[model samples]
Target: MTRLVVIGNGMVGARFVEDVLSADTAGRYDVTVIGSEGCEPYNRVLLSEVVAGKHDFSALTLPTPDSPRLTVLRGTHAVRLDREDRHVETADAARVRYDRLVLATGSDARVPGLTGLRNREGLTSGVHALRTIDDAREIVAATLNARRAVVLGAGVLGMEAACGLARRGVAVTVVHPAAALMERQLDEDASRVVESAMTGLGIDQRVGRGAVEALVAHGRLTGLLLDDGEVVPAELLVLATGTVPSTALAADAGLAVDRGVVVGDDLSSPTDHRVAALGDCAQPPEGGSGLVAQGWEQSRRLAARLCSPALSATFASGSAKAVPDRDPTSNVSDVVRLKAHGLDVVTMGVCGSQRTDDPAQRTLHLSDPDLGRHVEVVVSGGLLVGATCVGAGPVAAELVTTYTRRTPVPSDPAHLLISALTPQPRGATGSVADLPDDATVCRCNGVSKAAIVSCVHDGAATVDQVAAGTRATTGCGGCVDDVCALLAAVSTPAPGEPTDSPTTSRPREDDVTKGKHMIHSAETAGS
Candidate 1:
């Protein structure tokens, strides 16, 4: 049996293991998964929920360890990769041999270089960044004792972290170098709406200022010093500045490194075809695709190559194309990318590559400032090129799909966001009758409508239960609202029967701890 040694048991790595184990391949590989975290993989994207007190430790799990061929080593770090010897050394000096290697060493949040920030015990805490499940646990623990929190970035993470603390009744403030928040994913008009929504939730948004130094009184963080000579006081400081690829291990091994560990299209390291990298550490042809979807895809490609080497990849096989190139078939299989903030925002296929200034290019811009809503639909050459939405509704994903499929702009493109505004959208992606027999109702793992309906008929109540039964609405969660609707159609007892809540279908302890991607995608307004 071939042995596969996978490192960094985070989302992408854990996903690779699940895929390989579940696949009906020619031969099973002996899997050795090395995890730096003390526990099995959990959803890091939902760190905000942990901070918000919606879930303590109960709601975070990536996948399970059940395969007989799998040997999981938690709290062990891979100290070195020896390609010549076909072995890897854990930090404790245990060596494991492998026919193939997968590096899913996902990134860590970039802790900014701040001066004198400290914790309550009168010790310098420095900068705070959240990128792992353990990091979330620590931040949640710290927030309990913190009365005020200052986040030093207005990106999605900063906003989520800031808002989560605010939701828990902590005084929260966000500082951004840009004038607006989420500037990379949002435009001026849409950003205004998002800012309004956040401010309405009681988050202090600060811009055009940098923390010159952190104020530590005798060892604990008391406040931050501004470049403008202003002292802003807060009990805790979180630096959501950004992230860099976690590549120290790969770099030590002398693998090709750019923004990340440079790998070919098939995710094979340039130095050794026997070695492959997946997840945040491996920079695929797209060159360090920061999106989890891209990382998951790389894992899929590497798994296929390792388990079923004869099959050719759909995309360019050997020399990889840059991730920036728009491939119409990027959705050959379903992919779930989790970047959870309060907003249901999605960026796909070359964001901001739009002809905004051209009068000839058809564009529809709609905004209701009172509701903090803005939707921009730009159609050029009959392809839904780009869109931006920040508001009281769920239009970002709906618009992203239109742009992804190059869907024909309706006679009234304005209806794209409004058409699906049913109190609870059901069978609206396409008509139940017109949907091809293969169209997925639960797009997480490409479970078709027939599969879901069959499960509902087979005994599933409430959307959450159906999610466990069908694995639908468990990918990007864009479909959970629809799954809930399907549950409404499922046969149910008449009145007086207790309904499903967090009690009946709380998911098996194992499922909550490890089964599949529960974080899914960003929250659908209804989920």
Candidate 2:
């Protein structure tokens, strides 16, 4: 049997393995995945949801119950890639030989080039990056009592961070080089919506400003010095400088590099025939695609090529399936944010204001700051290219779907966004959220609703419990709210669940008292 070794078992690598097993494309592959993360494959797309208390971090999970042929080696990594020899060395110096290798070494937070961040104890604790699950947890725990936080970036991640900290009662001040939030995706009209939402959340937005350095005093972050000589004070500093492809090993191992690993349509590196890459580490066609779903698409197609004997390297673009829909659970965490205690802001597609100077795509936007509304849409040749929205009722999910799926723009033009902005009729059946169990939950983590349902039965009640129980909300935290909603669905009582039988007793532990009859054991399952 030919051996396929996958490195950096994060979202992308894990996705590749899953596609290999599930897809109908006929192939025979001996797969061995070496992941640095100790847990199962989970998402890293919505980490902000975790901070907002949307769901349990454990809900993000990818499984292989049906495929016993696959071997996933967790908490391990490909320390070195010998593309020529078709093998990789683990951090423990274990040499794993393979017929083919994969480089899914994802990116990490890019620390800014600055000064004065170092403290007297030479402590870098004050400097933080919101990249991994550990990173979000530390940021959350460290900012438990933080009075103020300085976020350096105007991108989607930065904006989300600003709102997330603010929701936790931390005074958040966003400092971005761009003049607006989500400048990459939304137009100026759409940016106004985000701006107003930020203001409502008590987030101080300072756009078109760059952080020159992180000022520190006595090993504590005092404030940040802007390029324009402005001093913004904060007790905590979050560096959302965005991520760069973590291709040091691949680059060091002599792989071709562009903005990321230059992979062909088949996800194999141009120079190394034995080596393949995906996710944040592998640059998809059209130069780059950071979305985890797209990476999974690549993984699916590649898995067919490697795992099945009927498929060969003569693959073409049309052979791959359409870009999968955004995970339904992606918004569940946010829904929890709205019903529960979280900042109610929504953004999709490109985050920042688009520039005429930039090439490709036309822009259309609507702004209503008085009502705290902003909507922006990007169009190219009558197709929804990109968009972003902020505020309570904007149709962000729809825009994201239409844009991502390359769905044709409606004839009315404004119908694409305006219809989304228009409130859905009560009892609306079709919605991005009106999904079934078979729907993928976390595109980043490859979790499903059925797996999450199993987790609910496993004693994971709260969102945090679910994250710990299933690893769902652990990654991007995007699906944190979705998982929470799912939990609510499972935990809440229906009209018929309770027997309504009279009882006489006192309060008991576990939220089920003697007289209350608060819960039904097996009866609730069907209910």
Give the winner by TM-score: 1
Stretches of candidate 1 above 4 Å error? 117-123, 313-361, 392-401, 411-451, 454-478, 490-527
Look at candidate 1 and tell me the lDDT of residue 337. Answer: 27
Q: What is the C-alpha local distance difference test score of each model?
A: 0.64, 0.63
Tens-digit lDDT track of model 2 for 165-204 = 7778898899988766656654556556666667776888
Question: Per-residue CA lDDT of candidate 1, range 270-321, in tens?
Answer: 8988888886777776565355555655655566555554433433444222
TM-score of 2: 0.74
Every model's TM-score: 0.82, 0.74
C-alpha RMSD between model 2 and the true structure: 8.2
- How many angstroms is residue 286 displaced in model 2 relative to the true structure, after the best TM-score fit? 1.9
Model 1 misses residue 374 by how many Å?
1.0
For candidate 1, the TM-score is 0.82
